[model samples]
Target: MLVITVDLVPSGYEPMRRTIATMSISNISELAEVSDYQIEATETSNPLAGTPPRTVRCLIREHARAQSVWALVARASDEIMKADSAEL
Candidate 1:
C-alpha cells in the first residue's frame, strides 16, 4: 500500500485551497485505478484570515500497486483525456 499526498499552494485571493486537485496532473490516475485509492479531505478554518474564517482543504490519497504506479496513472489519464476531448 502507498500513500500520495497532494499539497496545494494557497491562492492569493483565498486563504484556502481550491475544491479541485491543484497538483500538476500529467499522470495521476493510477493512484485511482478506476479511482483506486480512497480519497480523504480534511478542512481547517483559520481565524486570522478575517471575520469569515477561511477554510483550508487537505487532500490525501492511498493505493496499492503491484507494478509501476506512474505508468498506470499515465495510461488512465490518457484514456480519460481521449474521452474528454471526444465530447467537443
Candidate 2:
C-alpha cells in the first residue's frame, strides 16, 4: 500500500475542519480506481508553543492510484493554505 501525507495550513478551528473534510471527499472520489483506500485525519499541538498542526493521510493499495490524486489534492490544498496564509 501507499501512504500520502498532506500537511494542512493552520487556519482557525472552523476553516481547518472544512479543509480536511473537502480534501478527504475529493481524494476518495479522485482515487476511486483503487480497490482499497482509507484516510486518517489528525491534529496535534506543540506542547510548549501551543501551536497546532493538522495532517490528512491517504492510504491506497496501489501507487498509481495514489499518484492520480496527488496533484489534484496538492493543488487544492495549496490554495487553501495560501488563503489561510494571507489571513495570518
- Indicate the worst ten consecutive residues by lDDT in candidate 1: 51-60
Q: Number of the top candidate by lDDT?
A: 2
Give the runs in model 2 whose Cα sits over 4 Å from its true position.
Answer: 1-23, 27-42, 46-50, 53-67, 85-88
TM-score of each: 0.30, 0.27
The lDDT, on a scale of 0 to 1, for candidate 1 is 0.36
Query: How many angstroms is residue 21 displaced in model 2 relative to the true structure, after the best TM-score fit?
Result: 11
**Candidate models: Cα lDDT each:** 0.36, 0.44
lDDT of 1 by residue, 1-88 (tens): 3333444457655567454322122224554443343222222333564323222222223334455768545544443333312110
Model 1 clash tally, residue pairs: 4
